[model samples]
Target: MAKARSASQAASRSKQARKPNSLKSAKTEHARPDESEGTVPLELQQKCLTIFRDALRPSADDVAVLQEVKGHLYNRDFAAAFAKEEYLRVYASRWSPSRALGYVRVLADIQDHLLPDDELARLGQSDQESLEIVCLGGGAGAEVIALGGWWSVVTRSMPKIALQARFVDIAAWNDTVETLHKQCVTAPEISKYASAAAREANRPMLSGDAFSCHFHQQDVLDWPENVVHTVITPTTKLVTLFFTLNELYSASIPKTQHLLSQLTAALPANGFLLVVDSPGSYSTVSINGAERKYPMQWLLDHTLLSDSQQKAGIETAARWEKVVSDESRWFRLPLGLEYPIELENMRYQMHLYRRLATKGDG
Candidate 1:
C-alpha cells in the first residue's frame, strides 16, 4: 500500500511540471472570448495581427523615405518626399490620422450649423474684399484650416477678395508644414477659402516668392522685430490668435498679459483679432449614451484673454452673441470618444475682436 501511494504522488508531480508557466504564457489559461471556451477567437487574433502589421510596416517605410528625401528637392521630387514625411509625421506626432479623421467626421455631422448654405454662397461671391491675415502661434494648422473653411464660405462666391495669409509658430513639425502647403496648393475645397485662382495668380504674394506659404519659425514672447515689422504693417487687416495664449497663460499670467498688450498696440484701429481658445469646465457630453467629462470651462478660464481685454475689445455681429457678449463671435467644438488623445480633454471657442480706436486714431 505504501509503495502504491508513493508512485501516485510521483505521477501528480510530473503532471504539475508539465503545465505552462502562468507568468510567461502568452494567453491566460482561464480567459475566453466567448466566455465558454478558454481561448480567443481566430478572427480576433487575425485582426490584431493586421493592425500590428499596418503600424510597423508604414513606420519602417516612413523612416527610410524621410532619411532619403532630406535636403532641397524640385517640385517633382516633392511627392515622394512628402509621402514619406507625412507617413512618419502622422505616426510620430501627437495627433494621428485616425484620430483627426474622427474629429473631422464630427465636424461633418454639424456642417450645416457650422457652415450654412448662405454662408457658402457669400464665400463664393465675386465682389468681396480681401484681407491680409496673420495667424499667431498657429500649431498643426488644423485651426487654420477650420477657420479657412469659414473663410472659404466667404471667398468661394466672392472672387475679388484675395486672402493673403501668414502662419507663425514657435516651432513647426516639418510634416505639418508640408501637409498644409500641399493642401493650400492642391485641395480645391481648402483653396476655396483663399480662392485658389487668386492664389495661383498672386503666387508671389502667398509665400514671399519662395514657392511656399509664409511659415515662420519664431518664438511668440520674443518675436523677431523684422517678422513683426512685416506682419504689423498697414496692410494687415486680420490677426488670428488660435490656441496660443493658453500656453502662455498657464505658464505665466503676467507675461501673457504683457504679450496681449503688445499685440493690441500692433493692430490697426480697424483691424480684426480672432482668438480661438479651449474652454474651462468639466462638461459632460454623451456619445452613444456613454458619458464623458471634458474640461471645457477650465480651458477657457486658463486662457490668456483677461477680463479687461474681453470687455474692451471691438465686437462684431456673430451667431454666438448671447454667450459671447464681450466679443463678436463665439463657437464651441464637442469632445468625442474617438477624439485624438491630445484634444480629448478640451473644447474650443472663437473670439473675434476689433482693435479699439485710440485718442489719435490713425
Candidate 2:
C-alpha cells in the first residue's frame, strides 16, 4: 500500500481562499534574497505564483472536484483522479507553483554540486545545437517551469542556446503545459481582479527565449524502444522524474524498470538523470508470494548504483556515475509568498546520475 495522504495531499489544503478569480489576500511583499539562497529569484517566484493564480481560477464546483481528486489520488486511484480536465485544472492551480519552485530549488542544487559552467554549456553542442530535456510524469508543468527558470538564469550569457522540453504523462496535459510555457516566456496579462499595484507588478517571470515545449500523453511503459528514442535524444541533457518515480513503480515495476533502462540507454554520455520522490516506503511491490514495501530511494539505488540486475541474471551494460543523492531535502515556501491557495513546503528524496561513456564509444 502507498503512503496515504502524502505531500500532494498536504499541498491541496488551502490555508486561504476567496471568491473565485481573486487572490487569497491582497497583501504581497518582496522575498528576501538570502531566504531562497537565490535558487528561485524572488521576482520570478512571485510572477510564477501570480501566473498560476490568474490562469487557473477555481470555482466552488472546481473546489469540490479538487477534493474528490485528492481523495482518489490518496486512494491511488490515478485513473479516476486525473480522468477529467477539471481535476487537472484545480490540481494545477492548487499545487503546481509550489512544486515548480521545489524543482527550481533542486535543479539549482544540482547545478552547484554536479554541473559546472563549461559542462552545462556543452549540453547545447549537439548535432542540432539545442538542449533537450525529457520529463516523465511531468504533465502539471513543474518540470517545465523549473527548466525555464533555471535556463533563464544560466543562459543569460549564452542567449542563443535553444531548449526543447518534452513532457510525458498519461493525462492530457497539453493545455496546461502550453499555458505554463507561454506564461513563463511572455509577460502575463494583468488580471482585471488584480489590484492596481499588482497590475503594475505583473510581468514575465523569465525573459523571452527560444524555448519550445511538447507534451506526450502516453503510458511511459508502453513506449517501445523506438518511441523512447524519439523523445530522449542524443541532444538530451536532462531527464527528470519530479515526484513521479514512485507512481511509476506503483503502476508496474517491470514496466518502470524497462522505462528506466530505456531512458538510461537512450541518454548520451554526460547526460543526467534526476529522480525526485517522496521519502519513506511509499511503494508496495510483491516478491515471491507476498507484497512488501520498500523505500523509493533504496529501490533506485539498488537498480542504478549496484549491479543487482547482473546478480539477478539480468544482463545490462548500464554505467552511471552517481553525482548527488539525498534521502530527505526540504524546500520551504518563501516567506511573504501569497497565492490563491496556500502551498505546502516539499520534502523529497533525490538521486542524480550521469551516464558514463560505454566501451566502444568515441
Candidate 3:
C-alpha cells in the first residue's frame, strides 16, 4: 500500500509538470482581475502616493493646476478645460496609476479572445510576430504603462512576448507621454505597485522584460493623412482609446471620423478597439452646431461609430463588435486621498470590441 501511494504521488507530479505554460500564465493574469489589480487597492494606492511624492514629484503648482482643471471639468468650464497643455500633462500624472489598473482589468477580461492563439507568449522578443498595440489620443501614455505593468504580472520571465506600442496624441503631450511611459518601465517605485498588487493577492510574480512604446504627435485635424504613416500595419493587435472620444467628438465629429476610420481599417483581422470613456455628459453636446444632449452610449452608437462605419466602408459581418461593457469606480486621486465622486458614483464604462477576424481569406 505504501508503494502504491508513492506511485500515485509520482503520477500526480508528472501530470502537474505536463500542464501547458498558457494555463499557468492565464492564472497569473487573472490575479484578482476583478479586485486589487482591477480596482486600485488601498495598499497599492499607498504605493502610488509614495511614487507621486518621491519619484514623480508633482510640484505645488502642478497640484493647484490639477485641482483647478478638475473643478473646471466638474463645473463644465469649456474655455478652461484645456487652457494650458501643461494642465493636461499634470492631469495624467494625477490619475494614471489608477487608470492603468482599470485598463489592465479590461484587457484581462478578453485576453483569451484577443488573439487567435497564444503563440506570442512562446515567441519571446521575436519581431516576426511582435504584437503591436496602438493608443489614440493617449495622454501621458497611461495605456502603454498599464499594458507593460499587466505584461509583467502575467509573464514574469523577462518578456515572454515582444510588444511594440504606439501612442498618438497632439504635440502638447509628446514629451510627457514618452517620458512617463519610460518611467513606469524603469522606475523602481512604479514597479512596486505591480509587486504589491501581486503580493497582496498572494500570487506568484514573474519578472519579465519590459515592453517598448513609441510616441507619435499627430494633429487631430490632419490625422486622416497622418494615420497612414502611424498605424500602417495589419499586425496591430489592439487600438485603445481611454477618456479621449468625448473630447474628440465634442470638437469635430468629421475630423474624429477620419482618425477612427484610419484606426479601424488599420486593425488586423481579429484585432480589438477598446473605448473607455466617462459615461455621462460632463457637459452638453451639439450635433451639427445644434446644441442638445446625447448620452455617451448614443453618441458612440449612433453618431460616431455609425458615421465612421459608413465612411470607412466597414462591412456588417466584419465591423466592430462590443464584447465588454462594465462600470467601475475611478479615483479622482489614485492615492485615494480624494474621491471625486462618491465611491459608488465615480463610474467609468470599460468597453471592448473585437474586429472581425477574417473575410473569406481576404
Candidate 4:
C-alpha cells in the first residue's frame, strides 16, 4: 500500500511539472503563430557579417592561424588561443555570425516573457533609463552582435528603450569589442576618393544612440568577492552566459561557484539570467583520480537547482524560478548568406531563470 501511494504521488508531481507556467502561456497565446520562433533577419545577419569583415579585413596567414586557434581550443587552452589579434580575427570571422544568430533567436523568443509588466512599463516611461545587460565571457562579440540585432527588432513595437551591454572576459577583447561597437552604431568611414553618393549609402544599421557597450578584462574567479560583485550592479536587468559557462567550469569549479553566488546575490528580484552553451559533454572532472567527462547542462542544473550545504543545514527557499528551458535547439545559417569564412550551424542548450525574493525585502 505504501509503495502504491509513493508511486501515485510521484506521478502527480510529474503531471504538475509538465503543466506550463501561466504567465509564459499567456504570452504564447497572444503571439502570432509565426512569431513563436524567430529567425535572424537576413539584413541583420548581413550587417553583422559586414561589420566583422570591415573590422577584421583580410589576412594572408588566416588559414594557418585558424588551425592554431582550433588546436589551442581543442586542448582547452583558451588563453593561448586568444593571445594575438590575428587569432581573434580568425575566430570572429569563422564563428561569430552563427553564434550571433543563435543569440538573436533565443532573445527574441524570451523578450516578451522576460520582465513583469509593471517593471517593463516603468522602464519604458523613463527615456533616460536603459536596459542593462551583463555578458560573461563576451569577449568574442557574439553576444554583443546578438543583443544589437535583437534590440533593433524589439524597438519597433515597444518603447524605444536604450540598451547598455557590459562584457566581462579574461581575454584582451577591449579593442575588438570597441571596434565592433563603433562599426555597428556609426556610419562606415568613407575613403577620401569616394563619391558623395557612396558616403550617403554607408550608414550603420542602428543609430549611434541605440546601443552602447563596454568591456572588462578580469578572470571572475581571481577577483575579490566585493570586486566581483561590482560587475553586476543594482540596475542590471539581464545577465547572459553565451558559450561561456562550460569554459568557466573547466577552469575551476569552486571559483565558478563563488562567481555565480555573487552574481545571484546582486540581481534584483525579477531580474533574469540567460545561459547558452554547446550541448556536448566538454566539461570534465576527475572522479577518484580518474578524469571523466560531464555534460555542461547537468553541472549547471546541479548547482542552481539543488540545495547547497553552505546554507548551514537550514532549508532555504529556492532562489530562482526557471523561466525557459530547452535541452537542445538548433540555429542554422540562412541560405545564400555570404561571408569570408565558412559559418556553421549551432546546437545549444539554453535556460532562462528569474530571481526569486530573498530575505530583507519588504
* Strongest candidate by TM-score: 2
Over the stretch 1-362, how does candidate 4's per-residue lDDT look in tens digits?
Answer: 00100111112212322232122122212323333234557777767767777877734458788778767766556657777887776776666655777688888788877755666687778878888999877777777788888887766556467888898877777887888888788776679999988987987766667788988887766767676557777778899887667667866777777777777788888788899866663567777899878787777777776653347768777777788988776665555455655555566788998888778532
Question: Model 2, 17-70: lDDT tens per residue?
Answer: 112222344332333443353667766666667777666774445667878887
- lDDT tens digits by residue: candidate 3, 1-362: 00100111112212322221121123222233234444434444333333333434555456677667666656545346555766655655555544555566566666666743455554554646567787776645457556765665445453556677777765355565556555555444434446666656542122223466777766554655545555646777788777666666656656666666666667766778787766563325666788776655665555324533544565444456677766543323232333221111123666777766545424
Alpha-carbon shift of residue 319 in model 1 (angstroms): 23
The parts of candidate 1 lying over 4 Å away from their true place are: 1-88, 91-129, 187-212, 224-226, 281-346
Evaluated with lDDT, which candidate comes out highest? 2
Q: Lowest summed lDDT over 10 consecutive residues: which window, candidate 3? A: 1-10
TM-score of each: 0.46, 0.82, 0.66, 0.81
Candidate-wise lDDT, in order? 0.39, 0.70, 0.53, 0.69
Model 4 worst lDDT window (10 residues): 1-10
Choose 1 or 4, whichever is better by lDDT.
4
- What's the count of clashing pairs in each model shown? 24, 0, 8, 0
The regions of model 2 sitting more than 4 angstroms off are: 1-37, 58-61, 112-115, 120-128, 191-203, 206-209, 308-318, 360-362
| Model 2, global lDDT | 0.70
- Where does model 4 exceed 4 Å of error? 1-37, 58-61, 115-120, 188-202, 282-294, 308-313
Model 2 Cα RMSD, 1 decimal: 5.5
